[model samples]
Target: MVNGFMGRVLRAVGMAVRAVHVGGIMAGYALLFGAAEARRLLGPRRAGHGARAGGLHDGDRWVKMLTRLGPSYIKIGQLVSTRRDLLPPAVTGPLSRLTDAAPPPSRRRVRQAVLAAYAGTRWPFREFTWEPVACGSIATVHEAVTLDGRRVAVKVRRPGIQWVMERDFALTLAMMRALGAVPKLRKMPFKVMHEQVGSAILRQLDFPAEAAALAELRTNLAGLGNVRIPEPLADLCTPEVVVMEYIIGLRRFAPGDLDAGTRRQVVQAVLAAVYEMLFIDGVVHCDLHPGNLYFDERAGLVMLDAGFVIRLPDEVRRSFADFFIHMAMGDGWTCAQIVIESAAHVADDCDVAGFRAGLTELVQEASGAKSGQFALAPFAGRLFDLQRRFGLFPAPEFAFPLLSLLVIEGMIKDFDSAVDFQAEAVPVLRRRNMLRDRTAQLHK
Candidate 1:
């Protein structure tokens, strides 16, 4: 057995060496071809048939590339999609296509993972069907019945995921380092943003930690009837596996498959929950994509994947409240102040006047504009360019707002094409401010 294991290791090392040699040769040839292609197509060469066939800026190309590279690269695109502040709309906008879910591992692997997570459980596998109900890069989920016949969703981490993830991350980081050293990327925030996103993804892949976060969120949102978090089944829970209350019904509203009215309600509920998290609860589920949220038509809102929650400091939360108010009242000065404060860490050397001028212009322009009339896609693109064109304010943390702002606003517009963002938001801002004042009075 020892000799056989050693032989396998030696064989594996030989395979790795051969693979690297072939890969390097391929890469060199590809680079030569690519450089020649670029020189011919983009260089001083005559504007040839190349320009015609270049056709559309199909981001789906990148999506397919990531898929072929495997899970880590796929997640990198999703992470990139969120950072509109760091990337131009041209790059970040196309990342939205990266939401295709990962292929599921076999049901046998899922059961083994579950059993491994709960080391002492000799419980028969009969308790849960081996069929995977949902699957993704980090884990797959299966609906199960307990010995007592309780319906629950069993989430099991993919086999050997940790090692593969670690290897992929190391490779990605090395690639980022190389890319950062590139002349074009040296001035951009993509490298820093890449690291931050990698960190976020790492935290999310830790299933035990996610289970704990789920526990806290469920507790915090306990009394809210409109929002629901699945209760973790403690007895069946483990670092690599989590069991939660199964939500069976769905179909009210999601990005796809919703009437305007239903979509609007879903949008409102989602944003309001975000409001509650930032202001009232101080915690937010950061990954707010459609897959992370569901409309349980019979019950209400159901949020999944508690792994990527972000907790804001009190001062930050207050700034949020202030932004909301100023946005509502069209108060440029206050809005500018909040923008400065919110972004102080990023643009330390920024001309406050210029910063305020830019934000104020946007706020005023968007203030009373009818919803569908104003396209924020270009606005997002403009901001990305502003950062690149001007060395003014470079902060990595600012990426979240870049992500949240467009996401929330776009969701509103997507749901109610006729509903102006400023119009809908102003009323909520007024009510929240009023509530704040009354509550403050009671406290005093």
Candidate 2:
């Protein structure tokens, strides 16, 4: 009993320390950004230029602070980087460059995790590199050759990552609760948002689940001839370690390096695969950041990392498909109605007519815009801002599907600026009978 009490007390002390550290960094940056903004507004012309430089400096400092805070904050930065609507370009631009790379844990730690994962079984690797080829917030991956001479990537979870993440999540929730006490913030579904994000982060620790997701995605996306998913070696996978095919490709590729034909093919395959996942399969991979995707001339679009996958219910899938189809067709009224229907919460004082009008305008503006003309980042930002304005809190099911698309938009635009992102989804929408039903419903 005494030991249990002591453990609780220690955990409390640790969280308190963590809170102060996190709060200090955030507060310091906030003040720095505020001062820069003030200078930009009220100072002389030279001071305005200095303020602009200061903003850029603050953005870099923000990235550094998040990295120093460890995995949870790094992941949070990546997520916030997607919200171009919530923050200015100065902040989001620097954040978009925040990769998940971290210094590898000790070799002893990696070996211990590997041994524990393979307990009671023969060590299967013929050759294994002690140095990690890639290290990220959750795991470090080493190149290995199996006993049968097959090359693979051995991904081992960081030591005590679960405990560390849990502690950070607790502190984050406590902070959110404190924020929730403010009347203006109380309307936002902070608890639900935290639960959704927290659960997804925790889920990444389950290597077995990730392995299964990879297998399922491989099977589901096999029909997309040019898209590839790394096949997880099921026999070798465990909660702590996952061995998969070692894909050889470049995560950063110059578009000009690829022939136009290859680039178009690659872009088409990626869009088709993503649309299939969102509309047809209802099984979506939420993390498609640059690090998790690769391009190979031979292998085509190589998608990696299935650690953050979400399966939408059939109803939600259909609703979202309907929403997208209407949005494409410029049926803004229907889009607005779908938004209301699919929202997780409708505020008691929600401006229903105002929301519908605002969303209608947003959709109408987006309709028929090609990738070059239509930027999903800013559009999503506007959409989210509108939702917040009208007190229509988005369901996680709805939000994640949108995030899956948002994460890939930049890559797609980079690959083929002329591609009509909305129009490209028509064939898939038709395949799912969504387009036909929508037409009939509208005509009736």
Candidate 3:
């Protein structure tokens, strides 16, 4: 009884200390950014000095604070970067660049974790490297060769990471709750957002779940012909460790690195695969950032990391498909109606008429814009802003599907600026029967 009491006291004290430390850093940065914005607004305007320049500066500081707070903050930042509606372009722009690289734990710790995961069975690997090939917040991957001489990647969870992340999330929840006392912040659903993110992060600790996702995605994308998903070794996968086929020669490439024809082929394949996931399969991969995506001449488009996948409900999938289809056909009223009908929450005092009018104008402007004139990032920002203005909140389901596309938009544009993004979706929409006769007439 005494020992248990002591443990509880220690845990409480630790949490308190963490709260102070985290709160101090956050408050400091908030003040710094506030002052910077004030100065920018009051100072004389110079050539090339404007909100964009100031925003970039503030973005750098925000990145530094997140990095300093460690893995949990970094992961949250990466997730928040996708919500273009919540933040400005300058901020989300830098947050999107946040990488998950961290130094690997000691080799001894990794070996112990691997052994603990396979306690009852004989080791499957004939050769295993003690050193990690890559290290991220939750796990580190090492190269290994199976008894049958097939090479694979073995991912081992970091020791004690789950407890650490749980503690961090608890602190984050507390901080968010305190922030919620503010009237403006209270309406934003920050608590709900944190809970969703916390749940996703916790689920990522389950290697078996990720392994299952990899298998499901591989099967779903098989018809695409140009995408590759690593095959998880089922017999070797455990809650704490996963073994998968190791792909080679996967590297980042620029638009100039590939021939024009190859670029078109790769971009089209990627778009088709993403649309299939969002519309047909309903299994969307949310983390398609550059680090998780690579190009191989032979493999085509190689996608890695299935830890952040989300399965959308059939209704949500159909709603998103309808929204895109209507948007493509220049039917702004239909697009606005789709958003309202699919919204997760609408304030009691929501300005429905204003929202409808604003969204109609927004969608029509986007649809009529010429190639190279419309961009998804800015459009998403505006869409979210409009929602915020009218107190309408889109379903969480909308964010991940859009995130999948936003993460790859820059790369797609770089590869082929003239590519018609809206038109590309017609094939999938038609396949799903989402393109009604109205769409048929427009396409014709």
Candidate 4:
């Protein structure tokens, strides 16, 4: 098992390291080449046409480059696309394929993990099957029952998963820092996001942490009759193993698969959870991909995998709240001020005035849309452009908020064509900001 862990870890880490160094540099050159090609093709005679073609060309190259950069960077590419709060979707919009249906682990290895976690201990149940009903990168679930026939779900950690995750995460940070400067991970007030995201990876390795998080969430929403979080069995909780009360129902009934009424309920439920995470709880379940949420016909809603939680410090929360409201109220100066506050350790080479101007344009363009729609894809492009030009960066503190928004945007788009993100977000944001504003001296 140790050898298996080390071997897998080395393989993933080696690949990630190579991807960022070799793949990133090669892709950078390719981008430079493409820019030259487009410029020469259109010349000064048609700069607008050239820029348009170049934009498309850049998009294509980034996807190809990320593919070559290996799995780790590819995952980051997907996160980049979804971060509408930090990025306009335009840049990441084209990179959406990263998180789409990853390959599942083999059944044989999964069984081995189940046996390892249980250590051959016999269950009181007449039959406890070991087959994966659901799957993801590092884990899968098996349905089982107690001796008295109480239905439950056994979540088994994939063998060697921790090794691979840690290796990849370490390599990613190394490469990112090699490319740019960053402070420590979450332990540091001024850390890089590459470092911050790694904390979630580390925390997720310990299943006990996940069990505890679920317990706390249940406590938080215990009285909210409609919301239900599974209870983790205390006797069954271990670092590598977990047993939880099961909702014996199919998970992930996609938006189009249900009747309009059911679909609307599902959409609203998802929206409400997202709103509460951002505005009320401040602790977010950062990964709300379809599979992480369940619609129990009888129980209303159930959320899973609280291990990957993100809680922002109060100061950063205020900054985000202020930024959000400023955007909603069309207060560009306030918005820019809040955005600036949200970043730390910006590049010395960056032009403060130019960066501010770029942000001004972004907020203006986004706010100008006929109904204040969240034009994510285009906005992502502007965000990337801003990042490149001004090095506008994510403080370790805002990591959860940004990630939460990304997940929410994707969920919103799944249901409505006219899902105006700005409009949906504004009201809740106003309330949060008002709270912060009151506590912070009332705009003195």
Candidate 5:
């Protein structure tokens, strides 16, 4: 039919437009890389522990470009900001400020997603706010009230987000392939990083998972009287929408806004809660940065954004706990041993002795640092790099907790410089070990 022929023509035209749009963004990134190469050739060289001579200028530009490119790229930029191993401080430091808040979806789209999520099931919301309370890369959250008068937060996915994400990921992988061809970049785990992060972003698209994670966290963290997680309304949640009981906060706390005592309490509460998540519960809220964490004056530190959760197997969790405990205690040999045992693949040609030496030296350097001066992010990043050099590829589960640690370390440092991380974590580590021992004995 003539109509079918016209439809085919329209489809082709639409494909062409999308290709051009994506191609234009790719071209922008290419130009940025070209500038980086030019800087390497012509600019003054800088050197230091984490010195990146040419990358400093590119970081802000990358941020701008990612922002303009839309949600998927913005999400990647936020993730890459935390990846100190893949990028230098000059780049990651600036990119760390990249906010996840994006423009909100139209009210019409919100209504459609909400109706679909609650289709044929006694509509839960008595009143749904038209304007969004929060708009992030994955979804926009609106304030709503249940039929029974419970205040809730309804997170609605942006229309066509998944399709856009898929398109952008394909483009990103293609670009990675092109970049990986360069000899200097060949050894870097671009594919692993891409696959890991891309998969995480995709997984986050599942709102049901987020809802489940929130419920699991609430149950697991019940003992932590001060810490809070938003309560999920299980029956109302769907893949595109998560409806959770909302907690009212007087305000999100800034580090300097609180007194020293309050700050110390907040930091300790966070450390204890997060330690439980990693060592005991075996599930972690992978994104625990400042923006995702809030202080409810009455309810303690409130953790948000449960989309990027990671679950570790029992063995992996035990090894991770042992590794951190040893690292905190300055036992680099034990830490290195744990890492070797935990790695996914160790090359035949790996120099075991050399790895041990490097690890020992690295740990010594870090543990010897003065209080408030030690940086765990860079330390963990260097450890990752060392593992790569030894041809040891760690499991994705192993890397995520380290990234969480990096985020937590930064948050704690901002709150209380005087708080001794090792001393504070030691008690929790001991408690975890004690529980493990008790469990082992019970099984025997």
Candidate 6:
């Protein structure tokens, strides 16, 4: 093993090589695809030559490119997909299809991690299947049976993942620093957002924190009869591995498979749980993608992966909830003020009136002609664009939860559910405000 400055130098060099390799792959695809599109546009308009014939989408080539680069690249693609505010639907839509699940570690590595956690080769679990049920960048989860005959899922962090993740993030930060010098990119909140996201991903490498988050979320959501969080086996959990009650279910929602009543129950349950997290709990499971959320007709929704939870300060929570409430009510000026207050950086000469006027027009336009027609994702996307013009930058506290809400709203809409996000979330906001007011009066 390497140590001291020598190790740092080696790691930096390795990251540079990886970056060049990945960057080359990305640029190659861009050039090839750009040429194809140019040919199609400028050349003869052949009857058979269209987007479908060229590929599933123009972004399809990128999916293949990123996938070929390996797990870290795939994870990056998945992360970028959540940025609906940054990328257009055409770009992110294809990226969302990039799967996080990968091939499991070798049986020897899996058994060794479990043994290391248990402090010996002898394991407590009666049946520890070498085959993993799911595999991702940070960890792999396998199905196992405890000695007491309890069905549990054992999640083991991949060996050397910490080192890889550290190097990758270091490289990411360096790239961001390089990009900071660019005139156009300098205005974006890349540095702050990257710091927050990088920290969250690093925290996820620690399984004990994940177990704690899962338990706390279960306790917080206990009253919601429809939501389910798997019980973590505390005695068996370690920083390297976590054993929890196994939940076997299908991925994402399939409306045709379930009865109308069941579908409504499922949709309502998910929305209510999300609303409560945003407004009441003040902490949320920041990664709300479909893969982490499972559905069972009888068990309701099974939420997995607590590694990326975000805790909001009370003031931030209240301001965020109120912002949405005002947005729902079509009070864009108030929302603008709330955003300005939450901004990490605001220009002295920023035009508050111009922002308010533009945002009001956007809100009214997105408010829809009637109920059930408005969308929160598009509205939030416009706000992201507004930040560029107004010199108001997002703090991590605000950006993370806002992105979480946007992702959840997109999931709800994907199922063609007519649930009104503002209408549903308004009650949560009102209730939270009422409780706050009551507590304040009591304190006085």
Top lDDT prediction, candidate number: 2
Tens digits of per-residue lDDT, candidate 2, 167-211, equal 888987887888889989888888888888778888888889999
Global Cα RMSD, each model = 6.8, 4.2, 5.5, 8.0, 5.8, 3.3
* TM-score quality measure for candidate 2: 0.87
**Deviation (Å) of 437 in candidate 6:** 2.0
Name the regions of candidate 1 deviating beyond 4 angstroms: 1-63, 76-100, 124-126, 171-195, 221-224, 252-260, 342-349, 374-377, 387-395, 405-412, 427-444
**lDDT, candidate 3, at 427:** 95
For residue 245, model 3's alpha carbon misses the true position, in angstroms, by 0.6
Q: Extract clashing residue pairs from model 1.
A: none
- lDDT rank order: 2, 3, 5, 6, 4, 1
Error of 5 at 82 (Å): 7.6
Q: Candidate 2 — worst ten consecutive residues by lDDT sum?
A: 48-57
Report how far residue 167 has shifted in candidate 1, in Å.
4.2
Q: Write the per-residue lDDT of candidate 5 for residues 19-47, one digit (tens) a residue.
A: 68867977977887787767665554443
Model 6 — TM-score against the truth? 0.88
Task: Return the top candidate by TM-score.
Answer: 6
Better of 4 and 5 by TM-score: 5
Candidate 5 vs. true structure, TM-score: 0.83
Q: On residues 1-444, what C-alpha lDDT tens digit does candidate 4 reach at each position?
A: 999999888887776665567656676867776776777567657754434444443555666666654444555665555544444455555665444433445778776666666675664444566656665444667677877776777777767767556666766666665555443222222335666767776776678888887887787556546677788886766577777887866455346566666655565566666666667566667776555666676737778767677766767766766666666566666676776666766665657678777778778777777652666656655764675566566566665776676665665555654566666666567666677678689557
Candidate 4 TM-score over all chains jointly: 0.71
Over 1-444, each residue of candidate 3 has an lDDT whose tens digit, in order, gives: 999999999889988887787789988888878887777776556434444446235666777888767668777667566545446777877776664455568989999999888898998999999898877667888999999999999988889888777778888788789888988856666687778767777777888899999999999999988889999999989889989999988777456567889888878888899999998899988777665777775848888888888888888888998899899888878988888998877888889899999989999998998876778888888999999899888877677788888877776777787778898899999988854566688988
**Model 2: which residue pairs collide?**
none
What is the Cα-based lDDT of residue 192 in candidate 1?
66
Clashing pairs in 4: 88-379, 88-380, 89-376, 89-377, 89-380, 90-377, 90-380, 91-381
- As a TM-score, model 1 comes out at 0.73
Cα error of candidate 1 at position 147, Å: 2.2
